[model samples]
Target: MTIRPIVRYPDPRLVLPAQPVTVFDYALRALAADLLETIHAAPGIGITAPHIGVSLRVVVLDLDPVEGARTYVNPEIIWASPEMILHREGSVSMPGVNDEVSRHARVRISYQDVDGNLQTEESEGLRAVCHQHEIDQLNGVFWIKRLSRLKRERLIKRFEKMSRN
Candidate 1:
């Protein structure tokens, strides 16, 4: 039950791509648990290993009341629908900063569970948006990068002000 510190935006570590998790042993399990603890503490719906400066391609999403925490290790998007949609996306790393991001309406993803079992899921709407967002984080693509110049500038300005206060 360790709530690791969340790495904030503009941190170089957050920009560096996370390495894929190769081992499915105790350390990886511990990391998943830590991610869950940290995200729940952040009161956020999603979080990744990179958000905690661990630099691993691991993500934890709370599906609570259904299956609790769902951990994805080394996730990859296999396919995306031709259709698109917009959803508000934010990061646990970049707190208080969010914007509506356009993404494929549906996506097929392949990933490993916390115990290292391979799994695949096809999702749409908000769920698809979240999976894509977290996948971008794993690939070192900050959510701001998806925004237009004007929106990104404004978002940064707002984030700075929040940091000050």
Candidate 2:
């Protein structure tokens, strides 16, 4: 496993939608492994392929150590709860800054395993938040975009100031 460099905030690549994984081979597995290593090194609960400049629909999440890490390829949200919840969200690309963002309280997603097997999961609470966050990343929607204009600007300023120090 190798920890790859994470793309920082405001990078155009972060806003570009990632392509779906067409091939499930060694390279895909390698990319997933690298993402796991990278997220661990980033000290984050979740990460997407786009965060590392890989435009593939891949996500790695390690919410519970006992549950271990999971890799999702070509993930898509199949359903979401109308009920919303506010959660503190941040990005691996944008460190040292976070803000509360509203997201669905529950979500059901359909995705493929690293080996290209189809799977589905229903999640609520933190896991639900994470699934939405990472899926948004894959769709070229940065977490900050979910914020209000004022909140977005403020957080951008905070991230900018932190970057300079």
lDDT assessment of candidate 1? 0.90
Question: lDDT values of the candidates?
Answer: 0.90, 0.95
- Writing each residue's lDDT as its tens digit, candidate 1 over 31-124 gives 9999989988898988989999898999898855586778899999999999999888888877888899999999999999978899999988
| Stretches > 4 Å off in candidate 1 | none
Error of 2 at 106 (Å): 0.6
Candidate with maximal TM-score = 2
TM-score of each: 0.96, 0.99
- The weakest ten consecutive residues by lDDT in model 1 span 61-70
Give one digit per residue, the lDDT tens place, for model 2 in 1-165: 899999998999999999989999999999999999999999899999999999999999999989999999999999999999999999999998999999999999999998899999999999999999999999999999999999999999999999999
lDDT of 2: 0.95
Count of backbone clashes for each model? 0, 0
- Position 108, candidate 1: lDDT: 98
In candidate 1, the residue pairs with backbone N, CA or C atoms under 3 Å apart (3 or more residues apart, or in different chains) clash, namely none
